[model samples]
Target: MYLYFEFAKPKMKKKPNKNTHKIHNYEYYTSGRYIDYISRPSAVYIQNDNENRTTLLAEMDSKKLNVNLFMKSKLLINQLSEKHIDGYGFKEESKKLEGKTGLHKLFEKNLIDIDPKEAKEEFKKLENNNQFIWEITLNPGQLGIDNQMVDKNEWNEILNKHMKSLLKANKLDPNKIEGYWALHSNSKYPHIHLGFFEKETNHSNNYRQSGKFSSKSVERFKYLFENSIKTQAEYQNLFSLKNSIWNNRKEIKELFLSTIALKNKQETKSYEALSANELKILNASKVIANFYKNSKSKSYAAAKNNLEVKEAINDIYEAIVENNQKLALAVTKYKQEFESINKAKFSDKYSAGLKDEFVANEKDEFEKQIGNIIVKQCLKMNAKEKEVQTSLNYQEKDLKQDFNDDELPIGLSFYPYKYDEISKLKRMIRSLNYEFNRLSRSQKFQALRKYKKNISGVKSKVIL
Candidate 1:
């Protein structure tokens, strides 16, 4: 995930000139005059101070700091040795396998000398548990307009400084968070890949026990890196020029707008297929938001009579039943225990409200009070119960060829005797499609096993 920070506009003139009746001279930051200002010699006069730092930030297309953070239980040595290190810009030409310096060398050079025997012994302690291998990418972008402009040696030095600062800020020891890093310059956006396995540090006074970066720490790292980059004279000027050119380009703006539209369309479609629990909360919220519009009387029964309100209640009830059986059972028990009391309470409230004449504001307040109770109950029951199932199975009937063919496929298959079984299978397939559409990329990746199995096979067939 990326972390974003809004840069402060210290140059912004908040007040207008009273005598001259002139507007605030906020030309340094305004997007409209940005192109014109940059084109003229006057822009050179604008000093690179705290005031225009935000303008520099605004000019950049890639505003947020990106850290592609990953943690795996498997060690990096095995992963790298097995040729499993794909997509991290590891080249085939420079690759070494047998008797070469591997991930272990990173420690010796950058942090500490980790003896192979000692490291293996330490790893054995948490061999079966979540012994993590952290893989991270920092500042995955072009150094300058032309990659040639950046000095590789200087860039590496600055990068190392920033990375160490980030680690120190997050309470990670350079020795403990040891990893191998390689800068891949072949790509347009030059990036570095860092890989390391977690080691138990006996020096509790120095290193963090977990050797982990929390979300908050990551956010802090993002800010620190951005500030560090800005503070450096070489990078600040290079990036400022590049970003101004990028943001002022017409094609970039058009591309961004088109991308945003497509994203909005996709999000709308996904939002339509919300989870049962989400739908309940959404419907309830809508009902509460529009409570004042309906219900002329201050009566709870009057508010309940509204179709939207009634539907919202029904949705909430269904959500509660589906989400939490225990909560539903408790409510069921409450109804049984205070059956007479609830009935009497309802009658009293209805009679009292009907008999008295309340103003529109009072009626609105009364409606809110009644709606609040129902919404609260629904919300209380809407907690998601953890699902621990490992597999999701769905069957597909192979209708590509003749069903009675002798030369058939080779996989376990079954024939359903009853019509309801076929119907159930169809329903299962439909549900899978619905879920696949609604789910995020990560969810789909996790559920790929089910899709891979269900998509290609048919029941009642076995051919090799």
Candidate 2:
């Protein structure tokens, strides 16, 4: 139920009135969880041309609204059509229904009361569609121009490139995917909201499907948003006359037709039983994959399953793990390369030089960007090594506290189960410690801003 709507009234040539031409907003979503109201909010706006026509005034990103999916539930996107848009909806809607009504209305209702001293509970009740879910948000003014976002001027070419590449890969028809352009400037920083329809409907909005949209029901909701912005932008002339994005229809269409991460036929592989040799090959491949993922040692992983042919599998695995000591050294080397940049760049004195270098050299810029990925791999390898070392340490400790079952496999302990039970204590300790660290980090980062605010307040007061 994560949704974002931002309005940008033209800041350049055309400015619209925020006062005279007001926007009526409606919102929809299922609510749960206490996301920081100040931190998390989605905005979409309506553009309006002022009566004076001189200022071309508008209220861009003036307000934000948040919706949650657990307690306070909101839905009703399929409701908007030409016949019934409800111009005077909110006042009448609440009288019509008691709780949050539509998408835009949820924003207005949320803004009514605020207790800055505490975080308010917007969630009315908890509902379950439980799984590991994550979300990201962007305000028009706040969203940075990069590869992650479609930069306005650079967007056309980027979109076109993606379209051409995808078309060559999938052999898709441009007409099958429809594209529309809209500039909603009724908000702070002017932004263009381009909508692309897949034309093909997804079967599992009911949940349990691979290759889903950015949001669970992102496509449908985005369309409703797109149409709303289109109507509003056209009425207000939020688009620029000189630098209009209107003419790039061909490029825009290509972007719309580009590959979507979501699809109906998610799994394209055939289902069949594997033979004995095939199974062994699969197992070897799986082990190598897991080792690479867990070890971060590409050398170890590559040697394990370097060649795909049947004869080479064993030889490859042996070659890869030929000597564990050598493999470990290679891992250390790679790990050092990964950390050398960041740890150096972030240091107090050296950081200034690193920053200056970054400004001057594209190589430094590229390295800084990818350095985290290298470090992440190194950390994963270290974690795997720690796990193995911890396991070995526990086994040695267990041997000392042997059980009474002397009749079993060689050094049979006094009791088999007793030895096993005592041995796991170290592992349990490590597991608990790992969880504690993760939770502590989460709490600290989330509240860091609030702590700074308090510190600033204390410093500013007159202490005569």
Candidate 3:
């Protein structure tokens, strides 16, 4: 799951600024004073002015500063670069524009070919008004990303790969795309700030014309990033867990089918004939029947929308989980492994809230899958039941028609033995009709022919 993944909306300006000023602003805010202000322990500073030199130092004399004034002073000084006597300001070393303390070097597709400072100047020289600035923030601690896991080189590679992907997603040629990114580490939550524009502007591209990045593009980037970061083992575990959940769902469906079959059997038997296990299945089938009766719509989407139907589905799902030990165990294991992976990637120390959100999201997805399976199975059973009922109705109609014969011997009642024989033949014909109705269509034609021939012989014998 993603840990505190944030894609800031792409910044667009109605009136473009000077390229020099834009590049400077992007660099200064993304990797310079912005980082210093957020990472600094305190805003309080003291100015030491003497004949020799003037230096700004972090204040050591806490007793001399008012806490309330310090906060208000910090708030008043919006720009961290601004000089302040009692609020946050860049230190002497931090003031150097070339210093890397708060400034991360810019990187591109080929790291060796581009010098960080020179790239900034080159980007400034680009004559494009359609340039876009994008920002992505990833909490390292939460993402289980430490320096050891992803070094600077690997991070640059990952960024480069995703940059190409992003360009292609926007319908721009990757080969012609020019972009630079800086991975800022000064803040607790490390982030990447990227600036890019097509070298040869493609006005035909919808993204360029609209000047908006699609949400699909952002989500794709996140997916790519997450996959790239996961270890092979982690990936395998996730794959296995997914398959297990699917298998469990299938098992639940089979259980429902078995219970449905048991219910059909019970319908044809007396209560005393049902064994304990059969009775249990019969009771379970009744619960399913109740769900169908109460549901206004058999559609899974509709069922989810209706609170009552949703609750009934959940209740049935929970009961199945509870009763089937293997299914219950598999479900428990899946949740545990899922939560474990989440915690490993997004440590609780940095992303407790995000971790919880991801876990809940996974749970919702699982339940939706199970719910869909149940709805489909139930609908299938309902269709089969209707089919069986229709066949019975047809059989009853055939029975009535077969019995209404216009050509019966007129004096059959006068001969008592002949009347009894004719009555026996009628009963035999009824039995043959029942057996024929049960036969397959292929077998039914032949069975009907045989029954007709037998009936004709019986009628002739009785008449004689």
Candidate 4:
């Protein structure tokens, strides 16, 4: 089970008012665990075989203390130091056992720094020095935790490392704060109780007004404790999975770069010379062009929402993957490793469903990355095609200008013919015009008369 945590401030009471209610003013000094446990006794005390356990009957029979104790620090320390609390006073493997004499002192922090008598006097001197209390509970039967797996030293170390993080998360200054914690070893669930307050009271508004630790602080500590108790083998498995994911990402990135390079290489080639995969990419580019024309945003997210754009992207992605065997192998290996680790660790139906959901999320992220790459490549190709078309249009305009120039004959004009035929026609027309201009007036007349005589001769022969 996951770690459970709860927080609270000292009990508060409403100020006396006849007409309107005022805010409840919290007390600075109160008995800590004894007051809480007596009010709500939830857990059953189970006696273990090896150790001399404290009987629940003794707790019920003990005289109760006044609810409103004036000396809060002394009462709090005495309650925390109680010997009958399970896992608090006794060492685990000690053979010298008795009813309650063999119990060890509870492990404590920062409390020993201040004398209880002096702390109680100091508490009385302050007006608004309220403290916050919280507890962390864990079940020993959980998969990653057990009685032997964690000890006082480990808990102390983990808490010490994250204490500052917790304080900062809750907007408290670590330097100004003083705190204490004690771990109680119940047979079913071991838990720790902690409380903290400012050493010298400051009337600053930066402190949390909610009087409770933030959820961020709770989650941070939970993660810290969970990671601390993880076994070496679990760490190795997690490291291997992360390495596989890194390799998979690298392979995908390389595949995208290579595809872009290939497109650039084939940009100048004629349509007939392109291979099947290249042709498919070219068609995909046109689809992407239309997508950009109609869509407001050219982002991959918007592209994937359109059916035509989605299919085009998938087709291009599949084509590239088919041709790149390394990428295919890397992706397959990553998925297999992920599933293998998850299955080995979690075998129940609910865990299986969670694993499936994780895999789907990973797949969606990968597809989004690949889709963005495809869109970029297609846009590049479309730009190159437009550039080539613009160049051809300019050349055609120049050719039309040459044919319609005033130096040429009036009947000569531009025609949509092959380059060679157009060049030959221009040459023939120029030559005939040059010869006609070079002839003198009388010589031109003589040539015209000769042309008419030849036409008349042909007509007479036909009549005959």
Candidate 5:
């Protein structure tokens, strides 16, 4: 699943000098929900700092992660890959049992597929539910433009107006389907995640509605949702700049692996008994790293392309990779940086300072391994892409093709700066998402075994 993270951080700013009575200009970091973690408990699932992770782990239970949906999907997909699932593709399989109790029954007949819990299922059963799920998040210590202290209640009202407008413009029926909005007041932003349900089937599993769901249909929903995001009054400010998204499963999988590697490194570097402040830094860093990785993978095909920012991010990333020296320099720079940031005397700087101070700290070869590691990891693209790029570079030097129209450049370079800020946010969000999913999908579940028949690494036993 594609994950989203916040790339921007709020910096110190002055409100219009009304009576010259000013408030504290605080710097803050933020994050967004990952696609997979939709079912995970929102409170802790969205939390990223190590201190909170430790605190939440102590305060929460294993039951809270609720990753059964993810587990079942994995197992079923693996099983079908090995054997043609009921000798039918997913579309035909669904068509076969169109009128009957299809979803849970299909799971029973051909390994189970998970239906999300009561709340999500109930929410989805509403008429045009997918079209009306009003989701918005806020950053910590943020406020509205003096519209009478816009706390969660006030935010709810603002969102309500937008929802009503959307419902009207789209010719939605409020009478037929009951809609409700709930504020997740306990969260950092204390934001809202609302859903409207068809009053008729809101109480039960509506299999027929799900019968209409498919990957292609979901893509359509995504297209509509994105357009709605841009036009919706409440969301316009929040999603003013369209965030980057990765569509291909293979590319997304590589991004997941890359995130895992970065998270491991951050955890290793983190000190014992991390304070909330320190943990927040960790969270911010991970999010920045994540945005950089995901935004760079888009092909030229998607209409929602963010190529300008993508290329800029790539150039910064390439400065570290594509060579042994540049990568090593960055690693060494950050190593000294890791120690320096903790010092009490050093003035606090934002991301640019954070990165510049990193590179400014060193000259010795003896302390450059960490820089090399970071640089090397930066180029971890898909194998096929890497091979193609490498071959193209070699061919460029080996044989010159001279027609102006037919000329091709060696390969695109990488950049780390444009979105490194966002990658930090993505890292923390992914870490929380992964940890939560892992907790719920652990091997002990009975449903897991029903599905593991598909994923177990079995060989053909070809006797050579």
Candidate 6:
């Protein structure tokens, strides 16, 4: 069992808090294992350390923190609305609850029907000076169960069952916590929102507060709610569907890259082993390859069948292994066809710098020219002898004399120490090299291509 409420162990000769003897228990499922989590003694203060918090969160991640479902749980304090009660009461806001079930108005008891206008008064009476509201939202598609599979009635049943246990863990009974809850199907994803006022300790006294919750209480409630989603085969199927849709473009790119490597006779055991990411990509790539083969007759029969794409990809790979030129050409041609399709399939943020086509080609040409120029420049510079210092002190004296003399060019001349000369020459050469490399391939090609443009006549400057 996991411990939701933690404690700092007592030190030597130190007595534990008497209140620590009591234990709080709750049930939740984690990593496919059903667990009954218990709380530490109430008197034991929780230790809050940044490093420890990070470590705990990482461990929670390993446990699949959300139980494969998404839950948004929060506490809202001092947010009162007359419309909130009216909406729950199915007033003009009845349209919001039209087809949804589990939508109802809550009361303090079986009596005292709190109207929309009296919501603030009733909430203030319960909360007194420390006023707040609590909210919980359970999202669908997070659980393996399809949102459509569960009808409105079944959805309400699930929410009520989970809500009871959640409130019980926090020392509040669902019957006692005056709140409004409704299941909303109008959203893209089905979810239920529960709103409630904080309960005060002494009902007769306004100053006394009770039924408050700790951060741990909130966490336990979340865990209890997530585990309520029953695991089924449909969950796994839904997960696969979501994964494929999310990684569609990514898989395509990886598959294409892998196919290219195999075509060039490169070692690809790493790709062959196929990690989860690579496998998805390879599957997409194979689908594209299969589509290429059937494109000749202007018929893409294989594209219509998702299952056949894998087999088709395999056939194309085997052909490439046998050095089939026709198949290679087909695959290459298909890659071009899919370029625009791929761009349209993904967003600009995801597809950024995917291809260097124009900019890249120009940058490559420019950098190559710059490298050649740098080599020639370096050789020319290297041919000259570096100034040698006969005496260290004598060199320093010469530099001081140069600096003192006003006869040197206003900005051109400076004291030339050995290091200064080396740095100056290095900076000039480095700057030229960097500038050339920095130019876009197109820019470099354009600049150097001009020299070649005059090649029909007397060679202007020999093209690098």
Best by TM-score: 4
lDDT per residue (tens digit) for residues 312-386 in model 1: 555544554445555445435433433322232212333334223222233344235434445444333232111
The prediction achieving the highest lDDT against the true structure is 4
lDDT by residue (tens digit), candidate 6, 324-380: 454445445444434433343212322333332422343233223322322332222
Poorest stretch of ten by lDDT in candidate 5: 100-109
TM-score of each: 0.24, 0.16, 0.31, 0.39, 0.18, 0.24
Which candidate do you rate higher for lDDT, 3 or 5?
Answer: 3
After superposition, which runs of candidate 1 have C-alpha atoms over 4 Å from their true positions? 1-130, 142-150, 203-212, 227-464
237-336, model 5: which lDDT tens digit per residue? 2121111111122232344345436544553333335554434433333323344455543322220122222232333333323333534444444434
Query: What's the true lDDT of residue 94 in model 3?
Result: 37
What is the per-residue lDDT of model 3 for residues 1-464, given as tens digits with 9 covering 90 to 100? 33222121225323323322333344443343333432232321111122101011123124343332322233212234556564334555234322222223333433332334554555455323344433344433445232222233445666677757866787767776655544444333344445554556566543345435667886788777655655422433344455554565465556655544454454555444655554443343334545667667655555443343454455556655566676567667666666564665532223445445655566666666667765665566566777977987787667656553345455333222234666656656755743453344326535655666667544211000
Model 1 residue 153 CA deviation (Å) reads 2.7
Model 2 clashing-pair count: 53
Ten contiguous residues with the weakest lDDT in model 2: 66-75
lDDT, candidate 4, equals: 0.50
The order by descending lDDT is 4, 3, 1, 6, 5, 2
Candidate 6 structure, TM-score to reference: 0.24
When summed lDDT is taken over every stretch of 10 residues in candidate 3, the lowest stretch is 48-57
> Candidate 5, 149: how far from true, in Å?
4.8
lDDT for each candidate structure: 0.38, 0.31, 0.46, 0.50, 0.33, 0.37
Query: Could you tell me which residue pairs clash in candidate 4?
Result: 89-104
How does candidate 2 score on lDDT?
A: 0.31
Q: 5 or 6, which is superior by TM-score?
A: 6
lDDT of 2 by residue, 126-153 (tens): 1222211212132234331111121122
Off by over 4 Å in 2: 1-34, 37-211, 214-230, 236-464
After the best TM-score superposition of candidate 5, give how far the Cα of residue 337 lies from its true spot, in angstroms.
Answer: 52
TM-score preference between candidates 2 and 5, better one: 5
